[model samples]
Target chain A: MTIEFDAPSRDKLALEEGTSFTPKFDANGLITAVVTDADDNALLMVAHMNAEALMLTLDTGIAHYFSRSRGKIWKKGETSGNLQTVVDVLTDCDQDALLIKVRVAGHDATCHTGRRSCFYRSVRITDGVPRLISIDEHRHFVPSEVYKA
Target chain B: MTIEFDAPSRDKLALEEGTSFTPKFDANGLITAVVTDADDNALLMVAHMNAEALMLTLDTGIAHYFSRSRGKIWKKGETSGNLQTVVDVLTDCDQDALLIKVRVAGHDATCHTGRRSCFYRSVRITDGVPRLISIDEHRHFVPSEVYKA
Candidate 1:
């Protein structure tokens, strides 16, 4: 059976102390999902998940996301072979967002660009100009080689 | 000055290879901001930031977020004295989301619930029932005692 969320209560005490999982999806019927590497606590990638994506992840123990650009349910790493195994899922006090701990399988990469994490660069203001500096420059796999059929 | 976004290009090569900050905000002019502790890389909070909030965060070196419920620019910790000092801000490949690394001030709490982070509960399914478990149970401060003043 697909998972269903209880109706969110507006009362502060009930909302925080309640036992129901009432995710506050936005107007687009999407909730934010923040992913982190289970081993190192490094922020991996942030994505959106509809009810189907969330339910699938819960049911299958794999990461499923909703791709706004693709306008379809995304079984992450379905094409890249870098599937993510959900270790644990945590919801915030208000149940508006989720923190998903994952063990990334296959090349240990999460970014389509082959980076270990999507946040590979550090934004810096150097010499009064903003520039993106590559921090985690190690690519787990070459995108041209991976995404190619 | 408010931050302006570069036009989002659909060309995969250009979007990934280009060196401009072009965030494709949703119809609400909001981008998802995922925060992590600068010291430990632990996921701290997830919030939405308007262009004004983002520019102010960059310009002031402090975390500012747009409160959708309050419908205004929220200078974080303005009422709670828990100002977050921005350590670094990183944008993803397509620049639709942001990763903000910050060092929290005051009681080192980022959650209104007197917790270090808004995420304090782990969701699990046991015995065919979903339940919430308190994971980060350490309360750095008492919310009722702190927010009362």
Candidate 2:
């Protein structure tokens, strides 16, 4: 069965208060997805989802994304074994982006660098130039061994 | 003073571990920004920022964004008197996006609708069709009076 979204209503009130789930995909036919860990609510990653990916995520309760670099639908962590199980899906006031709370499987890592969250670095300005500082150093797995296949 | 970003590095290790912040802006010269409350870390809103806007935000310690629809730099809550003071700024593994923690002034609202957060609705699948349910109903201020200007 295919799940189709209704075209977003032009009326602002209906879009904000209504019960329908009409996501506004951008010109690239993708909507932004903000992922967070369900237990701690820490941001895990940010990605994009096409209609197919959104449908599959909602249908299967598994996170899927549109890989812009690969130009195809990506079942996230399919190769690395870190599949995300959806806990809650939320849409913002404008219904253009998504906030998905998820419980991660496998090594419980969300980033390719084997970190639990993609936001492991904090940006700080030193003498007017922004520098990244590693804030989270705990790596759940070794990337070289996990994706060695 | 002007702030410029170097081109993103092609090497994955250098891009991830390097201290330099070379954000990967899209073809539109924009990067995705995810916002959350500083105290509770509740997802507030998601937006985009151009190089100028990003620099202004970092330089001023105030949340600024690029309005795609208005085609200009937006000082968030400028008219509504709900200015967001930056608490922390973080970049994901790829540096294509930002996660900003902020403290909201005035009504303590981030969304234009006077809600404390943009993610007030939760999407759920019912009978194989996705539906949005209002999870939060607290309105901190009246939108009509706030944006009356």
Candidate 3:
């Protein structure tokens, strides 16, 4: 016998009006948005997606986000060709944040600076002092086409 | 006029007896732990530190973690030289988990296998299919000699 995987219906995906998504803030008081992949398992990106962006994400299949530095709404992969295709959206127990699982298309890089994501840097302590581990220039992969204006 | 930074007294450094340092889990079921550097201001790693490992971290400066894969206590830098130098610990509003901002030390890499941290991989969606951006090989740093043995 053969089995098939059926996609969830739209009605099943319909969330309670005004009670679908929420964002959680950490100790630093910064809102955290946990995004996952389509299978509902793999975490994609941990970026902040605000209320407006959340609504836009729901309205459109593409993921919309608020860039902390740019201070504006950024459609994922708009310039980099690394667009996020929204599959499912969820929230933590608290109705303050959202968990969006998306499928990325076009370019594999998600960060504007040419890295796959914004969280490429790692913080380390040496000699009892905090320091950032520097990435070797040769090992770094930044697509030039994305950064070109 | 002049100003100076005075070191903390031994008494000041000690936690009050009977005062638990563990974090309180939030309504969202997320745990928070804080690891401060020597100066005690800037955050290092914002990782989800669980109960068992949290206790281990308190017991020993060498961080012990709950391996999502092995599902057991994993001592930080045990296999990899990227050890987390745990400094001060803190909790969130609810006090369930932790925001472990450790001073990462030893080899620049932290991931058990050889990446900078465990989160070097990025998930993306292409044509409604979830995919991973394979950038783990680009991680240049390797574990130090001590842990390699």
Candidate with best TM-score:
2
Candidates 1 and 3: which is better by lDDT?
1
lDDT of 1 by residue, A1-149 (tens): 55766667888777676666677787798989999999899988999898889889888899999998899999999988899999999888788899989999999999999998888776776544456677777889998888887
Give candidate 3 misplaced runs (Cα > 4 Å): A1-31, A38-44, A134-143, B1-149
The TM-scores of chain A alone, one per candidate, are 0.95, 0.97, 0.64
Off by over 4 Å in 1: A126-129, B1-4
DockQ of every candidate: 0.58, 0.79, 0.04
User: What is the iRMSD of the candidate numbered 3?
Assistant: 16.0
True contacts kept of 3: 0.00
lDDT of 1 by residue, B1-149 (tens): 44555667788656665665666687899999999899999888899998889878888899999999899999999878899999999988777889999999999999998889988888787654557778777888888877774
Q: Please, what is the whole-model Cα lDDT of each candidate in the order they appear? A: 0.85, 0.93, 0.47
Give the interface RMSD values of the models in order. 2.1, 1.2, 16.0
Reference contacts recovered by each candidate, as fractions?
A: 0.52, 0.80, 0.00
Candidate 3 chain B lDDT trough over 10 residues, lowest sum: B1-10
